[model samples]
Target: MPERASARRSSRSFAAFDWLSVLVAVLQPDGSVQYANAALEQMLGVSRRTLVGSDFSQYFTDPSLIQSAVAGTHSHDFAAVRFEAVLRRLHQDGIPVHVNLGVGELREHLVVELWPLEQQVRQDREERLLEQSQAHKELIRNLAHEIKNPLGGIRGAAQLLELELQSPELAEYTDVIVHEADRLQTLVDRLLAPHRHPHEVGDVNIHEVCERVRSLVLVEHPLGLKVLRDYDTSIPEFRGDRAQLIQAVLNIVQNAAQALAPRMAQGDACITLRTRVARQVTFGRQRYKLALELHVIDNGPGVPDAILDRIFYPLVSGREGGSGLGLTLAQTFVQQHHGLVECESVPGRTDFRILLPLP
Candidate 1:
């Protein structure tokens, strides 16, 4: 009995140490915060006095999430529930956040850990997108100025030479040059399309965007794959460019569908569209009150780890015959709206997440 008591005390001490290691730790009962760790205070830029005894929901854009967490802990038969909430830091702009909240009974209070879905991932994606967009813009400008003019001159000269030729074989060779120039023109136009198009910004319903993408995908791969919707109807419309968002989401879903092509013969291939409201996500060096979490999840062998990190880089592709600018263009469109995009892939699953700020 004495040894068992000692072991229990040791476990309790270790639990306390474990909590200290987390980025943020909170204790709540009846939706009020009873305790918070130093890291929690540091993360929020607030003092413990300002946190304790306060309703944790006050910081969240959706207070109902706390109620959901409390109810989740009571039933063992219930599946684990995940929720997204934005919490306000002491800063002027409340940081938009995405948390995978789970509840556990800790003594008399509920212990919860708040995970920042878009924070760690957001910063890196934004940097890459900015760099990639600039690089593409420069390349397009240079190509048009340096390459297009020269190609046009060459094609024009070839046409003149063909007209002057008495030999039919010589004319045929000139025709090839003109055809190649036409092909180059098409390639240049495709590379410039996203930047050249004017953004039409307005209120955008995320579900509408997903449905549009689903319809388009079905037209091509109708019988081969299942495109499913796992939506959170509670998500609100945000100020965004509707046409751009549609293209952004479409590109990702299309890529996922293409990835499943190889595995189509094996079994049922699936792509799921999921959305939820996330409060307080940091994007482009600023935090917003409400953000949307849209996910394109697919069941395939998964993106290989070797090139996964550079998947967003232009000209990087995992499939043969892929132009490789699909994801890069998608990332550019999302970032222009002050949002971020990220991907997580492993065996049996590949997920692409788009985090856009709500108005």
Candidate 2:
């Protein structure tokens, strides 16, 4: 082959390669920028020209952490190290970015894959939550079946026993059994409702859904809890189960509202509904064409730490005398539509992100 022909083929192969993946990239030794994907560009709000020649550490909040990751990665035999460091994107914006650094010698240069730290964490969290939700569903089904028959027989026997007793105090004890059995039945019905009913899918305007939830929640609270909407007007319609999605979103927002009960009494409660379009989102180990990001943010005392990890588990509740199936059912419906649900909580702010795959 001629020299010119060989060089042309090599150029074509390099051009076809996907260098910028879902994470950030910073060249080692000099810490120069090789390339960043659309995700980084959108995140930093900067052009390729400005970022190409500069050091990526300048954008991070802690330059030392990046240096440590780089040195630690190179000192070993190309082992990856995880770091939780915030990026000082600009003067005003400091976004918390988790990064995993790994060094690979490629074409005589040490290339570092700046894996955006949250992607992996979010995936693991979603998988665990899904498993918990499914397990809850299975447990509920079995428990309901097992308990219903026995409760029926007990209630009947109690009625017959009540007749035989004739003592007022003994009859009251039978009434207690009947009342408790009825309550259990009602609880089981609520748990099985989603699986029993078929979801109605159609083109849904997300703004309308937010508006409906906003009105409903505001009407219920009516005083301290403020429901604010921050919707993207350019967001297009997608195929979704309108009623189910409404209920899912409503559940999350309502939970936030309930969390704000104390804050509301103190005039510090505010709930925000934020919407944006996300392209090429991966969910359930599969990438989607498009995804809708809906965030429910609250300015209140965050979720209790005791139940934080198990919030999606059935019967796990933060509130007194509350059933903890809201987040679980919300997750199930979202996952059914090929999406992911995520939560970030702290002392004053709690955000629940719902990512629904687009049509």
Candidate 3:
């Protein structure tokens, strides 16, 4: 009767850990799982009943790492030791996690905690990107406003100079000044474009946006480029600005076409428009139950490693004579919809993915 009561007391004590978000487990000195929390079961993609009494160390990439940690308890060492290890899931690839092992005084059982290291690193990167976006917005707005009026004055002065100059040499210099001023004006307008318009929110069908961009791109590049569509038709309409999304996607496609000029001449260029539903997605520091993943993929030389990280920043481009505002504008529009644009590239493939919440 006393042993049964002790087991009942242990069961109740173990139940207290079921609600934790972190994966927690109580293990014996020999590495057998005495109790597995709900989070641990979820992480392992298995049932608590099956997880308990199993050799917990077997689920890790290096089982000896876990066994060694458990062996520390035999020496009466209670200090938590931390190490990084890979946890093997039932149906998924192993995920890198930071493990903490220490013996709890209450039951003298080893308490093990496992948290995904990837999660913390991803969160840190997102935070840095958010901070960079805010800084870029402030810098662009201030710089554009500062340069706008002077550009007007310079253009006007050059016109006056052209009228006064009788010599062809002086007139050519005035033309150059006027042309450069006009170019600067156009750039300033693009820099301030995001702040000028109010974001119009309405029902948006992602496929419709994709078709519009596809048609526009095909019209521009009629000869060698083929635009293909692979869309998930079940994606529901979401609340967003339709025109902004169209423009954002269009910019990405246009950039790809421009980069594919070499392959286009060879008659082998292709751009694919793909969309699907993403569940439990986290980006821009917020988690969504569902999000739409729209990809603009192209077969071209990838983004230069030198400027890949800053492609979304103002005036950064990998191509010659490229204005570099396309990606910046696309990123701004997506951000207005509470989404983010990310890119992955290799030698012959480049994918620009835009993530937006779905209704």
Candidate achieving the largest TM-score: 3
Between candidates 1 and 3, the lDDT winner: 3
lDDT against true structure, model 2: 0.75
lDDT of 3 at 302: 95
TM-score of each: 0.66, 0.73, 0.80
lDDT of 3 at 182: 91
Residue 225, candidate 2: C-alpha displacement in angstroms: 2.9
Candidates sorted on lDDT, descending: 3, 1, 2
Model 2 steric clash pairs: 61-88, 98-117
- The lDDT per prediction is 0.75, 0.75, 0.84
So what's the TM-score on candidate 3?
Answer: 0.80
**Pick by TM-score: 1 or 2, better one:** 2
Give the range of the ten consecutive residues with the poorest summed lDDT in model 3: 97-106
lDDT of 1 by residue, 1-359 (tens): 99667644634543452234244444544667666665566567777677766777666777777667666664433444556667667464675556555667756556777666654565666666567767866776677567667887888999999889999988899999999999887766666777688888788888999999999998988776889999999887777889989998999998999899877666588999999887545656656657789999999889889879878777778998887878887887898888778899998899999988787
Q: Count the backbone clashes (under 3 Å) in each candidate.
A: 7, 2, 0
lDDT by residue (1-359, candidate 3, tens digit) is 99767855776788877755457888866778878877677667778778777998888878887777777654556455677787888744555445443334335678887766666676677678778988999999999999997999999999998899899988999999999999899999999999999989889999999999999998999989999999999999989999999999999999999999999999999999999998655688876668899999999999999998788988899999998899999998999999999998998999999999887
| Local accuracy of candidate 2 as per-residue lDDT tens digits, 1-359 | 69657544543443322333455554535666655544565556676557765787777777877776666666664456654666555523655665665555555234555556678777776677777777878888788778777877888888888889968998899999988988887787767777888878899998999999999999999987777788898888988898988889999998898888888898768999999988646667665546789999999889888888888777888988778888877877787777777888999999999998776
